[model samples]
Target: MNPPFDRLLADVLACRHCEALLPEAPRPVLQCHPDARLLIAGQAPGRKAHAAGKPFADASGDRLRDWLGLDEETFYNPRRVATLPMGFCYPGSGRAGDLPPRPECAPRWRAALLDALPAVRMTLVIGQYALRWHLPGSGSVSEAVGNWRAYWPRPAPLPHPSPRNQLWLRRHPWFETDLLPALRAEVARLMEDPAA
Candidate 1:
């Protein structure tokens, strides 16, 4: 992170545009670097991640890493992977699950943050909010994901890796049977490429 990028990131970290709607003091959790090759664009921090001040530090992260065939060292490496959720802080829980990321968060910050990462080669969009942002009007998560190849080697849509989605995974057997292997291969290639 250079001085300019550092300042940009600092601004993002200090964001509180939706502070009133969050579950706690805004503890924006994310990872970024100018050299990052893969971008993990997600909805927001889960309660566990908000507590840790780290993105994707829960069981859902475990499954996401498995899907990408990434070890923690590689996944957590800011130089290699960057994580920027729609909302940086935890939005609180609801009867269905975690609330949708605070609607105002991304519009205010995403573009500038994205501009800081010049080396991004691929993006893994997780859950509905991310899809809506990254691939608007692309249809449901399943539909966008089913059309993943069209975006090929970048911007792959994925269901949230929460255990709650076990049924979704079971229902969409082709995701594991097809997409995971391809995604893993690209991940390995990016991790190995020196320029990336």
Candidate 2:
């Protein structure tokens, strides 16, 4: 973390705007740096990630790492890869799964965080919420991801890597056959670039 990011991070961690409504106390989980070339814009933290105080600390993260063809070291390295969720804290669970990210998080904090990391070459927009935010009017996540080529060099929209999405994955073989490989290649290129 650079000086400005360090300060912003402190503020983010200290945030409690939704404390009264939150099931658990806020523990904003994220990784960032002044020199990150790639950003993973995911949904809110899950139970495990919230407990761990780290983004992508669960099975979903493991799958995402595989998709990017990245080892833990490279993926967790803040200078190379950054993880910023639409909602920084866990939004608690619902009947089906985790609830949507808190409505206030993105509007309050996203711009500041993005500004702190000026070297972001590309953002991996993961899950429905992030896709909606990054590629507005692009329709559902499936449609946005199916036409991922349209958003290249700026953002790459992807589905959530949670185990719950197994059915979607099974239905969309192209995601594995075509998109994953392309995503890996791009990630490699960006991560390998010294200038980035």
Q: Could you give candidate 2's per-residue lDDT for residues 111-167 as a string of tens digits?
A: 899889889999999888888788888889999889999997578899999999999
Where is model 1 more than 4 Å wrong at Cα? none
TM-scores of all predicted structures: 0.97, 0.96
Clashing pairs in 1: none
Q: What is the C-alpha lDDT of each candidate?
A: 0.90, 0.90
lDDT of 1 by residue, 1-196 (tens): 2999999888888888778777799988999999999999998899999998888999999999999889999889999999999988999999999998888989888999898888999999999999888889989998988898987666889888999999999998999999999999988889898665
At residue 144, candidate 1 shows an lDDT of 89
In model 2, the runs with Cα more than 4 Å from the true position are none
lDDT of 1 at 157: 90
